[model samples]
Target: MDNHDLVALSERRQHQVDGVLTAFFRESHYRAKALGTPYATLWETLERNATGGKRFRPRMVMAAYEALGGEEPERAAYVGAAFELLHTALIVHDDVIDRDFMRRGGLNVSGSYRDIATTAGIPLPVAEHRGMSVAIIAGDLALFNAYRLIDRSGVEGALRTRLHDILDEAMFVSAAGELLDVDFALRQRPPSVDEVVEMERLKTAGYSFEGPLRAGAVLALASAEAEEALAGFGRNIGIAYQIVDDLLGVFGDERDTGKTTVGDLREGKSTVLFAHAVGTPEWAEVSDWFGSPELSVEQAQRIREVLEAAGSRRFAEALARDFANRAWESLTSEALPDAVREEFRPVVASVLGRVR
Candidate 1:
């Protein structure tokens, strides 16, 4: 398939997924009204947060299913919707953990509640707590709905069972990764490159890419070998994707990336880039600035310069490219149909050019 065909296919898949999401939210809003005022409000907040993302996870499911010869677009839509809901839940929870008020340059789920409470004249501490509480419950509801969507997807009972098992494992692994991430941040010292990469693989890779792709393969009744190949591809590419994210956090323009650029440095995230920079000569000049609440854009730029001079930026970019290449090789290991392979080729181009 050519670029135009790929773009057209993506648009169609996006429309179908949106249709499923709209129907789900409409029904959820109706059901929530009977519960209470808070329930209704929370449901509305979820609907809003769910509306904005690129819906990348859902597209992953569709691509994998189609590549594996799954013919029913409606069936793929159901699976895509389930994965998208799962993505929504995780991001909501992640925002709470990160204490981030904005996503894609707009108020996030917790941020919305926080803003509402603060606007009502609640004290800062109390308002923040209340917002966090609402967000926690909102995330929980999203997760529950994700599983519900899959359960009602009308696939064979046996297939659904396998999919659930895959999802359950992914969630469990992701929770552990989240725990490790929190610990890594709280530690006195930065993590090693291997430690950071392991955390990323468990956290973002499993749920964001690996799980969705594998779930689609299961829906298509793909062989074990195909699933294995896709799993490897997903994990490696997901890591590369996260590395790109880390790069963007420090260097990308907020206008283009649609999020603040200094968050990672302020959070003192132990990315592979950080690991690469630690112990270098440049570390002494800026080690104290990371994790500082008072971090300035100027200081951020200085640190970016240090990271660049220390070769960390090149290190990370090279690592991402290497993984992208490996992911392509892994994808080709399976006898994926040619058309499917062609569809996936764009993923390499997209990932490689993400920060360019």
Candidate 2:
């Protein structure tokens, strides 16, 4: 399909997926209302949090399914919604872990709750605890609902089993990746660039890219060869996506990205840039500010300057391009239908082109 047609197709598929999600959230809100005020509030916050995303995961599922000649668009839309729920689950948990209170340029679930508590005269520490507890519950609900959506998606027998396996592996590998990220932050020694890359692959790629693509391919009953080829392409592109994300975390505008650029620096995130900056003279100059909670704007700018001077930014950009190249190469595999390959070209381009 041409670019115009592709954009139209994506919009239609996304609309289908959005319909499923809207119904899911509506049902959830009623269920929560039947329980209590707190439950209703939680569901309401989660519903809000789930909206306003790029909805990229659902789009990926639809793209792969249609490209591989899947017949059931509605069923695919349900599965696509499942992946978007998974994205919500992971990010809600990630915000708690990262101590972030904002998402999509506004107060997140935890932040909203925390604010409510403080406004009601609750102690700061207690309010923070309450917020985190509510966020944890929200994340768990999202995760469980993701599985529930898939189970009810009307795919039977082996196909259903394979889809669950894909979800299982995605969660499993992602948990390991999260642990590595936390561990790297606490450890005195910084991780190697290779280790950081692997961490990014496990944390972001498995679920965000590979699992979604492979799940769609499997749902379509694509051959094993074709499935693996698409999965590989996803892995490469996902890694590139995360690397650029890290770059944006440090360098992009908060207004545009809807996130604080200095959060990674203050959190001392062991990103690829940090790995490259280790042992560099420029990094040493601003190393003291790396993880300080009181890290100021001036300090952040200085660190950015040092990172630029150290060529860490350059290294990360090159690494991202390299992975994008690998993704493009994966599309060339004979196992992938030409239509499937063509569908993903702009996807790879978007990854390379994303500023946020």
Candidate 3:
């Protein structure tokens, strides 16, 4: 186990993804090849967008599998790559909707096309609209490819139906949660912490933890009891993870997190800390900033101070620890297999240690 090469393992798996993407693009129609700049170019864009990142979701799957005493690392890598594809598909669609021009210091799909059109002297609005349409199609295609990859994984049988159900449910719940999140942003009053937490659980945990890791363990023939236990653990940890993500979105250094501080402020995101700040009378001024297009970074900084004064940051951090502790409890339980427990624990540490 000590000799296992994690970097080499990652590259070999990435190569597998590259080969699959290459074959898919090569079979494309002539017009698509022309527009996508040799189909390989489009795949390369997705690959580029996916670069220099933590592979947390996939690693969670592997950890759960290893905890179940499974040893098929290559097969687990395929499971992970499929998830990365799914995640990138979500990112493509999300960036288009947000009109976000850059991600990871590179032009996002819509942004690149918009730039190209504008450089060619087209009107900015026309360029952006066309670029958005193209991005939407690209995102849809990526999602379709994700499903295809999962189907071709040869992970079949009674558990196959269960996996299918899990995926379907995750999609439905996440979409509903996302819709609610959009609605919350538009509301005069932000959502309560409980409501936001529920949304985070459905939108984040289902896909990020419950479904993928369970699929990995299922692939390894893990018992139903073990799978259920993992799901419980994952759900708690995922909520904590998303809450931390909210904190990072609002407070992390852009150079470190690959995003600007208080990005949630610009969007007026209805996160837990946002709720706490607004609810406190001492920080009640925060309500005035919600949905205020006139709000500036200077004002947001001051409001974040109010949040700090209200102990929201500390509150959120404590909550994060609570959820993480719960996951640790489950991971160490007798319900989990004996041989795989120690390896799985590191995954929790990895999740908790992420800077971004």
Candidate 4:
């Protein structure tokens, strides 16, 4: 299909997934209401946090399923919705870990609850703890609903089993990756660039790209060869995506990305950029400000300047481009149908040029 047709197709698939999500949230809200007002409010907060984004995971699923000639668009959408829920689950938990209160330029689950508590005259420490507790339950609910969506999807027998397995692998590997990330940040010794890259792959790549693509292929009943090729493509592209995310976290416009550019710096995230900058004269100059919870905007800008001067920014950009190129190469595999290649061509382009 041409670019215009591809865009239209993606829109249609996204619409289908959105409809499924709306129904899922509606049903979940009612179920929670049966429990109590507080339970219902939690579901409402989750719904607010979950909806509205690029909906990229669902799009990835539909892309592979349709490209490989899967017959059931509706069923595929259910599977796609499952992945989106998983994404929400991970991010909600991640925000608690990062001590973040904002997402997409608005109050997140924890932030929302924390504000409500403070508004009611609760103590700061108690309010913060209450917010974190609510967010943890919210994340758990999202995670559970992710699996429930897949099980309720009309797919049966081995297909369903395989789908569950793929989701299981995503959750398992992602947990390991999150642990690695926390470990890296806490350790006195800095992580190597290669180790940072590996951490990115495990944290974001598995679920965000590979699992979605592979799930689509399985839904389509594509050959093992085709599945493996698509998995490689997803992995490379996912790594590249996360690297760009790191860059964006440090330098991109907050208005465009709907996130703070300095959160990573404040948290002392062990990214590839940090790995390259560690031990440099420039880093030593501003190292004291790197992980300060009270980090200022001026301090962040100074750090950004130092990173740019030290070529850490250029290094990360180059690494991202390298991975994007590898993702393109993965498309050349004969196992992938020509239509599949065409579908992903724009995905690579978007990853390389994305501003948010």
Candidate 5:
């Protein structure tokens, strides 16, 4: 298909998935209402947050399915919605772990609850506790709903079993990565590049890309070679995507990225970009500022300059390009159809954009 035709296919698939999500949320709200819990607002918060995202994971599901020559767009829609729900569940939990009050420039699930408690004149500590409690429960609800959506997608028998196994493994792997992230944050020493790459594989590549692609290919009953090839493609591109994300976190305009450029610096995230500069002489210049919440704009700028001077940013860009190149090469596997290869070709450019 031509680029225009592919874009149209994406739009149609997204529209179908959005419809599924809308109906799913509506039922969830009603179910919450029946429970009559004061936490009915959780559904509303989830719905809003779910609506705000770009639906990229769901799109990946559909795209991968199409590439594999899956003829059932309706079935793809069901699986696509399931992947999106999983993403929503993870993002909610991630924000809670990060203690982030905002996402995409608006109050997150925890933030919404915190605002309610604080407005009611609750003590700061008590309000914060309440926020955490609600966010945890909300995240759990989302997590379970993801399974429910996939189970309800009607991929029966062994195929359903395979899909479930993939989803379960993805969540398990991602959790391990999150644990590593927490461990890294608490460590006195910086992470090595290898550790960073492994963490990215589990945290991002597995779920965000590989899992979705694998699940979609499974639905298409793709051959083992085809499945392996797509997994490699997703893994490489997913790492590149994470690298781009880390770059955006530190350097991109907030207006463009929809996130604070300094949040990652303040959080002391052990991203590949940061890992590349560790132990370098220039890194010593800004080591003290690495995890400080009190990190200033000037300090961040200096750190950015130091990272650049140390060639960390360039190293990260080069690494990302290498991964993107491997992803492109994976598409050359004879197991994948020409249509599938063409459909996924644009992902390379999107993954590794021009570094400023």
Candidate 6:
């Protein structure tokens, strides 16, 4: 699809998701009045953050739903919106946990709240504390809101129970993945490939791909065979997304992938690309590139050059394509409907081929 096709696809999917979300907020009353000051600001902040994202996870869910013979576009779209909200909430919390100041080209929850406090003449330290406190609570509230969106969804019965179970378990895995992120960050030694890939699955895949899409599919009472197949497709695609994300972190244009630009290098992110470079003989300066307070921009550029020269970029790119091909294979393997399956190839290609 060209840029026009991409725009149309995005518009159609977003409209469907938003209609459901609007109804959810209206039914739940959003409780905006109950939250005070900075806490209330979080809702506005999350709303601001939610609307502009790529919508890939929800699209993944919708695709899986369509693939499996489910035909209600509105229902599929709303489910996708729920997944988007869940992801937005996760990013809000993650930024605070990482103490990041900027996200998606703006001051994030913590930073915005800090600015609010400072503008009110609060001391810098006190303002910073208030910001962190408010942001944490805001993330918690977003998480609560996520569950409410799913639970109060118009759909009901034992299928809801199954969906709830899958969501709960996926949430645990996401947390476990986050824990590994922190632990690995603290490690002085390089992580093994096995550990790195597992982190990609937990921190990056299951919820981002498997959980949300499956939650939607199960609501349609997707068969056991269909569920397994979709799960495999999501898993491979999710891992591939993470690989591309890691590559972009180090190599993408600063203006395109606004979040985590150079964050990987400064924080020594343990991605597959980095593993390949460090393990290879070509990037002999890999350890020196790990980063230090004194490392200059020039030094960073040279290190990136070393990684590329070692074929880390090529390795990661090939792996991402391989995984995407596998995803297409799973998607078309008699588990999904004809219309959904027809678009699956295009969607996967478009997403995997993104530069940033």
User: So what's the TM-score on candidate 1?
Assistant: 0.96
Candidate 6 lDDT by residue in tens digits, 178-248: 88988877887777766888998998698888887686678667888778777887888888878888888
- For 1-356, candidate 1 gives per-residue lDDT tens digits of 66788889899999988999999999998999999988888899998999898989889888998888988877878888887888788889988998887888788887888889999999888887788788899999889988778866787678888888878888888888899999997888779888888899888888888998898888888898888888878888898898888888888888888777788888888898999999699888999998787899899889999999999999988888888888888888745666556767788777888744
lDDT per residue (tens digit) for residues 1-356 in model 5: 67788778888988989998999999899988887767567888888978898888888888888778888877878887887888788888988898887888898888888989999999888887788788888888878888778776778889988888988988999999988988888887788988998898888788999988888888888999999899899998998888888988998888888889888999888898889998688888898898899999999999999989999999888888988999999989999999788778888877766553
274, model 2: CA deviation in Å?
Answer: 0.8
TM-score of every candidate: 0.96, 0.96, 0.86, 0.96, 0.96, 0.88
Name model 1 segments beyond 4 Å from true. 354-356
lDDT for model 2: 0.90
Off by over 4 Å in 3: 1-43, 50-52, 290-295, 350-356
Ten contiguous residues minimizing lDDT sum, candidate 1: 334-343
Give one digit per residue, the lDDT tens place, for model 3 in 137-220. 777766776655556666677756765666666667777777777777677666888888888887667788887778777777
For candidate 2, lDDT tens digit of each residue in 147-255? 7888768888888999989988998999999998888878888899999999999988899999999999999999999999999999999999999999999998788
Local distance difference test values of all predictions, in order? 0.85, 0.90, 0.71, 0.90, 0.86, 0.74
Q: Assess the local accuracy of residue 123 in candidate 1 as a C-alpha lDDT between 0 and 100.
A: 88
Across 6-114, the per-residue lDDT of candidate 4 in tens digits comes to 7788889989999999999999899989999999999999999999578889888889998898988888899999999999999999999988888887888999999
Residue pairs clashing, model 6: 67-336, 67-337
Better by TM-score, candidate 6 or 2: 2
Q: Comparing candidate 3 with candidate 6, which one achieves the higher TM-score?
A: 6
Error of 3 at 326 (Å): 1.5
Q: Given candidate 1, what's the lDDT at residue 118? A: 94
What is the overall TM-score of model 5 with all chains considered together? 0.96
Q: How much is the lDDT of residue 291 in candidate 6? A: 50
Question: How many clashes in each structure?
Answer: 0, 0, 0, 0, 0, 2
* Model 1 pairs in collision: none
